[model samples]
Target: MSRAWMSGRLFGAGVIGAAVVGAGLIVPGSALAATTCAAPPGAPAELTRVQDAEACGSTTDGTGGAWSLGAGGVGFADAVDGATVAAAGFDGGAGAGESRAGRLLAVGYGADSLALGMLDEPGIAVIVTGPASQAFVGDADDPVLCEGNLAAAFNLTAGSGCVLAGAFRYVTPSPL
Candidate 1:
């Protein structure tokens, strides 16, 4: 559908753009008409995990919000079983505005499934910046985060290591 590709490194770990596209997580430049809210005035007008899920009637936890990604922004989205599930965007340049850390909640699907996906980028660790007890299982579907590779997720948590959010499967050992 006329996808515009990007090629670069993220967090100095793995390559961006191509990995997510190859994984078929998102169709770049696809219409986000499903989202009820207007795109933020950031560099790249796109939706995030919370926004798409909520707008498309996937979840209603009301965790959707926007963060300033200054310039050279990149966005990613995920769908499971033909339903739009999650999305996120990152600013490639110096970001603007306050940090939205701890604001976005790591939502899970029915029971065993989560609304997250792997970007197919090796060495790019998905760091969960929520409570200390917060943890996740990667694409390998490993029961623990240590055993599997840390898959990339959407993160609006500014000043954090990666812009992509973390947690494919929530594995909290304690209360948040």
Candidate 2:
């Protein structure tokens, strides 16, 4: 696997990308060599707390079918354990086209167990436009997005999809 790695923003993984599509969250473009996967460096400063448990978001599929769903979570991970994928539309089954804000769900190492956290954010646009098997995560099992670069860097990793996703440290309380 020959993955392209720039520098600086190689960290964590989100919920959407290449093969898996991050639960079901569609990007709105095709896949290719994404050169914009690196997002600045640090997480946002103005972080917000998730008021409710429901995820609010809108999605437009390839067929142009726009849909919305609340309380979108199927197999969401527990923040108490570790960082989890908080993505919308990623949650498959039932509602079909919706999921919890896997992008906004992140648990710190300890203490603030249920509070939202900020990790090194990756470029969703990159994963969205990069590969079908790539997505982003906040900091799951020691970073998945950046892990791709490492694996691909050493030609030791291969997946049908990759992710450049991560929960925003600066959440807006609810999904859009």
Candidate 3:
């Protein structure tokens, strides 16, 4: 279970989704039905160790809403209600207080839902639109984001679907 393995899992899921789509199987909008904004259901207990976790759910009409569970350090703003959930840190720590607009994008019915977890420099981000979703992890500056659905584990250092190398942020220590 390595970061590379996690990335591979994400990619594989995406391929499966694509294949299904190509076969004329329409993923119903209901598939993205709303749920309480929280860590994905059946998530591992280790997720509690994450310093922060953010989650959002998409409504039946395609509108999205978000909430958080943890230190309350991370905040979310909907760039496009029901389509995009933007995240920011309260105190402007590493990867905080910045717009990820250019780096993140979701179109059609998939823009309104997302989930994220941060522990120090390592983290994971997920965006859900109906049955289609995407997951990302690693360096906040240059993360490896992919489209698909899968259970993510934040506690494992390099487990499958875990954060990758260079995903950790290296903050400079302040002088005493």
Which ranges in model 2 have alpha carbons more than 4 Å from their true place? Answer: 1-54, 57-86, 89-118, 121-136, 139-142, 145-176
What does candidate 3's lDDT look like per residue over 45-105, in tens digits?
1111233242222211123322322122223332222222333221211111111221211
Best by TM-score: 1
Model 2 over residues 1-176: C-alpha lDDT tens digits?
23454221233232222224432343223212111111111331111122233332323222122222222221122111121222222222111111122223211111111111223322121122212222233322223232211111100111122322232112112112
TM-score of 3: 0.21
How many clashing pairs per prediction, in order?
8, 38, 11
The deviation in Å at residue 10 for candidate 3 is 5.4
The parts of candidate 1 lying over 4 Å away from their true place are 1-14, 23-33, 39-176
Task: Give per-model TM-scores.
Answer: 0.25, 0.20, 0.21
lDDT: the better of candidates 2 and 3: 3
1 versus 2: better TM-score goes to:
1
